[model samples]
Target: MNETTLTAGKPGQSEAKNNKMGRLAAASSIGTTLEWYDFTVYNLMAALVFNHIFFPSFSPLVGTILAFSTYAVGYISRPFGGVIFGHLGDKLGRRWVLIATLMLMGVVTAAMGLLPTYFQWGILSPVALVTLRFLQGAAIGGEWAGSVLLTMEHGRQDQRGRNASFTQIGPSFGTLLGAGFIALITYVLTAEQFMDWGWRIPFFSSVLLVVLGLWLRKGVDETPVFKALETSENKADLPLKEVMVAHWPRLLISGSVRIGSDIMYAILMVFTLTYVTTILGLPRSEALTATMLGAAVHVFAVPFFGSLSDKIGRRVVYAMGALGSIIWVFVFFFLLHTLNPIYICFAVVVGMVFQAMMYGPQASFITEQFPTRVRYAGSSLAYTLGGIIGGGFSPLIMTFLLKEYNQSLPISIFASIGLTVTLLALFSAKETANKPLAE
Candidate 1:
């Protein structure tokens, strides 16, 4: 074909390409959403019901801490999950591990939704719930890293940031979906009824979503990158060991980049829920509504900034996000302390937007940092370690901080951590813009 004909065909071809990307993005987004739906429901339940339902024997304050501890169980299990599934994903292919993890998460979450409360079964009920939460955590450990690799591997090298952002969008979308579902259930039923039977709707609803996500996933072609590794016979013999031996520095750098992101996530997702209801004395519904709205904004902001990273280099965009997070850290708490619900919502939305900058391009940057032989292991290991160090203790630490000093102390701590990590990640990491995949 002539150059003119080939150039003209690019538009039509581009549409086809985007359609494929959209499908891949949907599969990744929906699977991650359902996985998160299962995981985050624990947080929502922790905030609303777990204290009474699971840990009713403890003092109210003790119950809250205990409930949050169960939430942390999931994050704690993440590294093990990453190691296990990271090895599997690298060896068995991303598609199978992805599907398997989703199934495992769905089963555990549904069971949690149906399990009797501590009021009925006593301590066993809470123990059961904690066990299920751990399973959900491990499954999700595999889910996020695998989903990011799936989309990043399928997309063009130039658009990896945007594509990777789709995976990160899962949390915001899942949070909104879970929150919205709970809101609807509450609206349809009385407060007493919601606490009695209505709270289970969000968890029970996940089955249908999982099936739909699986259906979408079945149609996707395997990632070209994975296939290339398989064909080139360049796959790692011991993926986890290879990842550690060959890519330890990249893994550490990537994990550092995640400290701010994970802390911000906890600050926004878990701690803020407590801050509003306990300290600020806002109604739980108002707090949830504000959080739901902030998450709604993030669903768009993440992808927009992800796409923006396609034009600008990854480092610049990520550094901006980190800096924005540092600024927002103090402001987020200050606004919440002010106790104006509208201001609470505004501060949260802005904070999440800043969060999107780091989150949007992170999966691609992490994945791109390593070669395909150990890509899955490297990505999952780095990402999970970040979650463990950055997020695992965030709720606990924030609680301790608030109890130890004042609210401002937590904000100061958050800003310092965010700024320190942002600067470190900004200066140390290589820019991945226009870099070839599998390089």
Candidate 2:
């Protein structure tokens, strides 16, 4: 396709074609949203319920640490997932990889709900949980890049940021769904009941979501970019090798640019969720509710920032978000320190806004850096590697910082440092908003 033809709608194209594109975007978005819902449910459970259920033998602090460590296991496994699935996605196709990932994540997540507890299974309980969590990590590692490519490559070039932003909104909706479900159960159940079975419901419910996601994804066509690559002599025999040899600098920059948003998400959505109720003595329901509200706002914020990137530039919008993280790192903790539910909600919502700003433009920004033949491997590796460094250990690191220093100041500084790396990345990256996919 020529530049003008690919970037803009062809003259006399039917309205049905436009509608199909919209549906494709919706399918990609919804599938990713469900995937994230499964992941977030696990994260929230790890923070609140997993320690008690899976590591009952350990003391409270030890059990919590172990649970978060298990959570980190997912991140550690993501790079392996990225490489394995990324290689296949670039070689085989984006559709089949996504379908396989969805099935794997759904089955593993539901199995988590049915697994025997530490009391019933002895040492085997935590081991099973960790095994499932690792699989979950791997599935997600591949899921994200494929899902973004599905929409972006099919979308008009000028609207790639907006199309990719649809996938970014998934996390917000997923977090909202996961947190809202857990919050509802917590509100309705007694503390004993919640610990007993309330947590399992969310995990068990993932099967229905998986069926829906699969159905939606099955109807969508393969991305035009991947299809084009398949017919071209330019296709690499080893996409990963090509990525490393030809695109290492772009890969490193893509990963570095992700540091700010990933760390911010880990700190705000994961660590802070644990911090408020555990350290600050806030009610569990209150914390989840505040997070749910923030997630609702995030749904809107992602698309807004994404469309803004199409106008100004990806780097500018991303830099704004990184800067927001630096400024809000302290303010977020201060609001939580106030001990008021309203202030707590403000803190979480503001933090999500910053996160959305970076995440919104991120899919197109990173994908645009690489060509279609190696796009899957390149983007997935950069994103999941960033997940490992920036988000994977964030909760564990935050817990350690709080335990050692007994202050949020140290944690804020840690977050600021990650954002600084992102700022440097933005400065280094070429503006990709106007670039064609065939470049």
> lDDT of all predictions, in order shown?
0.81, 0.87
Highest-scoring model, TM-score: 2
Range of the 10 consecutive residues with the lowest summed lDDT in candidate 1: 1-10
For model 2, which pairs clash? none
Off by over 4 Å in 2: 2-4, 7-14
TM-scores for the candidates: 0.94, 0.97
Candidate 1 achieves a global lDDT of 0.81
Stretches off by above 4 angstroms in model 1 are 1-12
Give candidate 2's whole-model lDDT.
0.87
lDDT of 1 by residue, 186-271 (tens): 77899888888777877888999889888988888877777877778877899999878877888889878888888888888777
